[model samples]
Target: MTTRTIALVFHRLRPNAIALARDVAAWAQQSGCKVVCDESDVDAIAQGGHSHLTASSSFRDADLLVSVGGDGTMLRAVHSLNGTLVPVMGVNVGLLGYLTNVEPEMALGALDQWLRGTEGTSFHYDDRMMLRVSIQNGSTKQSWLALNEVVLEKQQSGHTVRLGVDIDGTHFVTYSADGLIIATPTGSTAYALSARGPVLSPRLNALLMTPVSPHMMFDRSLVLDPREEVIVEVMGQRPVEIAIDGVAVHTLLAGDRVSVLAATERARLLRFNDNRFHQILRSKFGLADR
Candidate 1:
């Protein structure tokens, strides 16, 4: 029998999350499986003399990567994977765990089932689409991946930044607004939803563009084909801040441009059951069946 490897990725600040990771590590060791953690989180998970856990800079070889926090932690795990095909299991320790598959109490059971294979257990992979974003400033260029939306907003408060939009190399419109959000179907329920953007099925292959507090009357979101590429150019004098998956990463000056499109790689989430999207949405929002 071949040895299996399980990687634990958790929110370092949460003591409960850390404790749960340690428990999972101990369980994996007892089950004759290798337990590892990201190098950045090794110290935290190795605390209290839990020295058996291995520290790995890469999780490409891990059979499974378990996220022991909320949706944000899951997003962090996906970003850390960097397009690796490793399957991620999410155990919710925070509120609103839309991305998580199970609760903390069921984590070990779920892991056991996953280890046992699908012969007698109900386990599957839920692949979700991701987005790739590129920024160009003169000769310097940078790129990042986002499981959620990529935001380009005004850098300074009380000022609206002007951004020019283009689709497939054709100029679209120029907007004076607080920001613009380019989101994948998986991100429809996130910040885009808060901005009044339409909710799309996570299984759909599409992109959503929503404007934030636009000065113009055309403020509705535009859902575009996944194959289409969107370009947002910085217009006027004010600089704009760029955020990937809600984390601020770069600042673009006037004349800089950002390109967004569906990534070729998808995030593989481990799931035990086939839960419908509308059902999950209704449960998440406490929507009553009238």
Candidate 2:
């Protein structure tokens, strides 16, 4: 099957990355491929002087999606995809390119590998785990998918929030902390790591739950089985906010509950042969094998 269509999703605020997105589009068109540019990015693509971009581009219809920015941009791209089967290729234009497949200078080469189906030899699909967060306040309910983590933070400033937790319906400890983070294996390296959570290999299918500055002695991070579900209920007088992948999605009232679990869906990331998780991890943290 030929990959005749490619979608380019970029972070609009990054000028240099926007320029690279346009160049990528132009290059795709030159290779007898159709370029799918998100309407929101149309203006950014225009900045790179592309006048022949294909019209009516949809993330659902593209054979592949390229994210041009940092990990955040890749997360945004993942969000836009809405858990579609469309594999995303992340091109790094910012620092600590954990999710991005290639550096800015290597963008074209990465594209070539994708176009040529250079799996194992140069490119492959690295399926990353995803998270689902559902917040219910009385009769109102909403859900959000996260490539990284779901955070519940205290909004009752000057005072710590009370969070009652349960794992698989068993009563866990009530955490008195500023916030809580429930991250997927893919997110283990992110906020969870900073909060002293253990680093799980990306290939492992697990979930990491870490409390943010809890006031109790039971402040250790919890690594749960993939099938286990986490339920956190707000017990404070004020409110707590639910942050999905760093973006505030909902406000949790005193009685509101947040249910987090491994989503039935997974995120597919483009990876080249030389880009294994351990190598990237070492490089990102400036570790020395010597």
Candidate 3:
């Protein structure tokens, strides 16, 4: 008998995702694998009833952590891992799942290959980024780590503001626009793409700076090397909002400076050899499979 421990994490808010988690857990258990999961998942399925599930708010030890949801849930799982070296596998519950790609039907088959040591493997480590954020009239002290992009925009629509972007203490440009987006390669396909930013390959070491509805069409997107540090200084008297990885929101005032740079940590996403980055991209974006 083979012994492998796996952590099954999922978004409890979605019924389909929860059901899929239960299925994966049940199958792993019957196949002689240990499954650490949340109680809600176990309770949802009769086969997973009375499972040795860990509490939702607590930690469980496992060799692999499985996330069942879309990209949002994957980010939550990354935070939950909290620097653990354990790799995470995503089972996309819905369409347009940028992070979650493995379909529900393919999950068990993939798991079988993974446990049998017959699967190909790759590393899709997270590119952590740093953020220097401040509130209006506040000290330049608030900072953050972002796995995706950071967005600065007007709190209310139909308003324009002046934003100065500086790179390494030099003036890059000033934009009179609705907002700006600073995204990592991993985040290029997200809100940044919707704002007209180019899609960056995941392995590329670069940052994408895109302006949202700039007053000047000349304010096209800018791609910078990963080593560069960016600072966004507000230049007008208007209420602005900052969103980090779509998880936290902060208010910024004119004269406040938001700095962004690469972070020290990396998010480890377990990848099997069968998983192809370009393939996933083409499938999601409807590009030619070739």
Maximum-lDDT candidate:
1
Better of 2 and 3 by TM-score: 2
Tens digits of lDDT, candidate 2, 2-27: 64788888878888888888889888
Clashing pairs in 2: none
In terms of TM-score, which candidate is strongest?
1
Error of 3 at 198 (Å): 1.2
TM-score of each prediction: 0.97, 0.95, 0.83
Candidate order, lDDT descending: 1, 2, 3
lDDT of 1 by residue, 1-290 (tens): 89999988998889999999888888898888998887888888777567888888888899999999999999988988899989999999999888896989998988898988783257988889999999876687799999889999998999999999999999999999999999998899999999999999999999999999999989999999999999999998998999999899998898998999899989999998777989889888999977
lDDT digits (tens) for residues 67-171 of candidate 3: 998888887776666555566788888668877757888888877766776434423333334333334345446666566788888877789988998998899
Clashing pairs in 1: none
Can you give the lDDT of residue 256 in candidate 3? 83
By summed lDDT, the worst window of 10 consecutive residues in model 3 runs over 122-131
**Candidate 1 wrongly placed segments (more than 4 Å):** 119-121
